[model samples]
Target: MEDETMSNTSEKIAENVLLLAVARLSMALSLPALGFVAYLLNLNLEQKFQAQENKIVAQKESSDRQANLTTARVETVERVAQSAIDQAGKVNERLISVETKQTQESAASERFQAATLTRLDRLQDSIVGQSNAISALTATLQADQDRNRPPPP
Candidate 1:
């Protein structure tokens, strides 16, 4: 009976050891599975962050392109406006030159007219003096002819 009791005690100790070992194994296995799950979660978060960064970059590039296009358009409009202003200035200069030439021509025409009028007045006075002298000569010739004819009759 004593030998049987010792045997039973040994069997109980062996059974307890087996139960402890099984619990430790289960814990060890579960640790690796938990680590794998954590790795998967980290990968997913990284992918999301990278995708958000890429989207932001694309938006920034699009905004930059739009700003550049607007700047180019504004520059083009400014150039056209400047060209128009230059053309207007040229036209104004041409008009001023034409006016000055017209004024000069008008003055010259007035001077010519004045000179012609003075010459015409001198010619009229000379003609009047010649007509008076011719009349006196004709009267003297008529008197001489009458005296010569009466003495013959």
Candidate 2:
């Protein structure tokens, strides 16, 4: 009976050592599996970051295109405004020339009127002198005819 008790105690010790070894092996294998899962999560994060960068680049390009279009439109408007200003300047020059010509014509007409008035005054003086001479001659002729007819009494 003492040999039987010793054999049972030895069997229990062997079973406990076997269970401890299995637990240690399982923990060691789980560490490698966890490392693999962390690597896959890092890869997924990198893919998302790259996609966001591409989207930002596309937005910047679109904004640049819009700015270029706006700049071109502003240039066109400025050109049109400058052209209109040039046309206005030309019209102003033409108006000034017309006013100058009109002034010259008016001055010339005034000079002509003054000269005609002076000539008319001289003509009036000559006509008055002629009328006085014709009246004296008529009086002399009447006196001479009356004297020659005096023997008819």
On lDDT, the leading prediction is 1
- Candidate 1 similarity to native, TM-score: 0.41
Q: What TM value does model 2 have?
A: 0.41
**Clash list (residue pairs), candidate 2:** none
Model 2's lDDT to the true fold? 0.55
**lDDT score for residue 95 of model 2:** 51
By summed lDDT, the worst window of 10 consecutive residues in model 2 runs over 144-153
Report the Cα lDDT for residue 85, model 2: 61
lDDT of 1 at 68: 61
Q: Encode model 1's per-residue lDDT on 1-153: one tens digit a residue.
A: 989967976775576567546645654565465556555655765676576556556655655565565556555555776775665555556555655655565565557556645654564465455444544544454455444433321
